[model samples]
Target: MSISRRNFAIGLSALTLTACNSTLGTTSNSGAPKPKGLPADLRPHLNRDYAAWVASFRNRALSQGITESTLNAAFRDTGYLPGVIKRDRNQTEFTRTLEDYLSIAASDERISKGRAAFTRHRSTLEKLEQSYGVDAEIICAIWGLESYYGDRKGDIPVISATSTLAFDGRRGSFYEKQLIAALKILQNGDITPSRMTGSWAGAMGHTQFIPTSYQSFAVDYTGDGRRDIWSDDPSDALASTAAYLKRSGWTRGTKWGRELAAGETASRVLQPQAGGPRFAVTGNFNAIKRYNNSDSYAIGVGHLSDRIAGAGPLRTPFPPDKYGLTKDDRIALQSRLTSNGYDTGGADGVLGPKSRAAIADYQRSLGLDPSGDPSQQLLQTLS
Candidate 1:
């Protein structure tokens, strides 16, 4: 649900469309005007089969002790979202090298923003750390990575998104469980249905806790009788993340890990990239991984937290990639390609889809095969 393991690139476009409608009926059932600025696929359309599915699901909701009033409010403006299904089915499965992961995770912009956010909320974060026994820097790092310090908390309605996934049935049982938990959250008066917005997959709030995780770990740190993570004030969400880490067995006073120098040894060492830096990790590293189950993710969080705490970058350099290019070379390639009229989005040292397309375009211009691959030769050619 944290999405750290899936793709580190946050989709800024989706975050811009928060004003889109959430109900199944665009203009009939609620008589609300059709939502503007939303993609057609994301808008709800009439589907009798989906209607029947919801009708049957209501019985199950009732059996689970969800009151009739809660069900009605939760489902009032909710509807099947085709875009959610599309996104679920078409998830891009790819791996990022530890170097690239760290580049994005601790990029100059993220580090700068993180420092400001940490400074702004230092008191709250430190208090949460004090209470939960989790490190404050770690909490800030998760917030930085999860929602860019609350800049991109998703806008899709959770009930609609969860119910659509539940009806789609590909991961029906899993989503059904989420839908039920969401309803329970609604029944608990933590958030209203209209305000219960989150990611397309139902990951919500500052740290993107899925409903089940929220039920288990979320806290009302504000003491307002509501565990409100969706609001601009991130006290509750930050506290919840600390609580989650505490629950996940974060050891107090233990470092997550540190990069090992040449000839350095430790009780447990991890070299995610074979020829890159080796890390001496602790139980706290595993605790970070419990938030997102990936070695790269754990390293990203640890390294970013360290950076936020004023540490320098890794001392050792990573070997050239399979394409025989280094991070600097990749960044140069992207910068050159963009200057040549083919945009690679930004020179982030990551050859993602836009970068690859730019490379392919440059290759075609040279009467070469458009393989969209990067190489030392290609970098030289661009130079």
Candidate 2:
């Protein structure tokens, strides 16, 4: 969920622009094979062999009642965009500390803007929650995080991005299906190709809905007969996110989570292997994770929502070791531990039990007290 792999826009505007710097083959008029010598990370499915992929996708779209003309317009001149693949590949690979992720995604400026949005759209938001059983703060938080309240709905052409990823072998089937789904959106006369721009991975709207998520969850809250998530109307986007959560098993009238006084010196109560956190996180928290798999992402959205709703910060420190650590730094430490034979499971920055065990093993190896506190000294040692 962290944008460390990307350079996003910063400011308070109704519209934002973004550009991706990556290596991928573009669609050539002559439809030649992909040029060789490209980095493995940047190489895309070449045009020479892209026909079968395109044909398969075209068939799927046509089966969905999408016409050939719409498909052609969306796919023609589209290229194998490397930036899209890069962003997707990097989405969950690296770990990030809570503080660092919040710094990028849920800053004070974003919170202020979120609060303002909540107030400005109070009537509509209230109606949405009343109908959908979701909170306005959660919606605002999602909006702010996704596109900075509609300021930065990315400009990459979804068709090219999805098409290239489909042709490429990495998660090729998934992206290929998404590419067809996108064409179906166009064929249905839902939105224009020109207006169908989004993240390199095809996430669009104020709350970054992927093509499939949009198809499954997007709604026309304004009764416009079109589910236009790309429009300035935040209602549809907010409602859609709420709907996604609702369908994903969000429990109404319960908090996402509460801060807990996790004990000191590696208490069993604070450890991730304890099975779950002392603080009770409701099912809605899981629903947030459905949007993104990372616990840190769910926590950020939940905590930011609480903040926007005029709630205070956590009652306890998010355990000691997480202090003073940024998202990437935590990931780096986890990576080091993993490489050193400490199996942290993933490089995700959260100091889960596995990471703590790794830390303990590392400390024991170094002849230090194996408390697994994630202390500043331990971090320094790891560095």
Candidate 3:
């Protein structure tokens, strides 16, 4: 999941801290140093360093043809965001089986909301489908998965998030490119710097386009001279997603994929979990992967779109997940965990990292392996 959806869905694993080479003392490479007298008043020094870095970056943006006005506006109050680094390093909450992922990604509630959104934007979706030759439902599914049909279009400032990641130096070069691309977007006047907000990793808009992806694929489909994906109106966002799919070799009038029953002649079958549902994916499935690059994510988009378009659930039954527990058992386990002081977030029944951490904590108390894999025996033990 390399897309914004992936960035948001997957955790950043651990917080990444770079060596700040300012006049202030460098963070210790060894154990915490003894109190080395009164710590220097390093705030001003660090502030100046950050300001200088921003100035240098602004110069680079200028060299790349971003207007001085855009750079100035985008960086007016630019400062390092430590929270962005924390979130960027956050690992996913839970490891999920395909079934578990589907339970959340293509759940009934999501599908219902998706249908409503689809109906609300039917005219616009149809026109985009006709123009781009990509299915309307797929676009809607991408929108739903990326930002919950525009209901959760993220809140982190794009400039701060990207710049902090660039400064952090963990993935410095990649994030630097994103930062530059974001400035280019500002220069293009697609959105005001004040409104250029997105996920902590800088995936922006309803469809979660990273700055570079937006540069390559975003479109001003609304003809308003601005490819405004940040607006409440999702017309441009949806249309941009359609354009991306179309350009990614989306086949006109072909299904993204079909659920393959046992013995079905499938060109390519992907069964992420043993004994779980299998799918015969098409080129369109690959096209969706170009959006997020996760097999589970691509399937979620394809299956959710199929559901929104009135297709039935997969006839093939999914086995218990890797934890050897079914979906209902997982829900019960979450409820028990929360009630037992583990606080598995909510009983939404998706086993993300939080739920697993809770489970691991409980396991540790009992001297268990702390693998955090839920089993019927663990549920009974908790009971």
TM-score per candidate, chains pooled = 0.92, 0.68, 0.82
Worst 10 residues of 3 by lDDT: 13-22
- Stretches of candidate 1 off by over 4 Å are 1-29, 33-37
Find the candidate with the highest lDDT and give its number.
1
* Ranking of models by TM-score: 1, 3, 2
After superposing candidate 2, which stretches have Cα over 4 Å from the reference?
1-47, 51-60, 86-92, 261-278, 318-383
lDDT of 2: 0.67
State the lDDT of candidate 1 residue by residue for 152-230, as single tens digits. 7777788888898899999789889889999999999999987798777888888888898899988999999999999
Tens digit of lDDT per residue, candidate 2, span 242-334?
A: 888888788777767765655523222222212223445667777777776656666778778888999865554343332656456677888
Task: Write the residue-wise lDDT of candidate 3 on 96-157 in tens digits.
Answer: 57876777788887899999999999999999999999999999988887777876666666
lDDT score at residue 45, model 2, on the 0-100 scale = 38
lDDT of each: 0.82, 0.67, 0.75
Q: Superposing every Cα of model 1 onto the true structure, what RMSD results?
A: 3.8
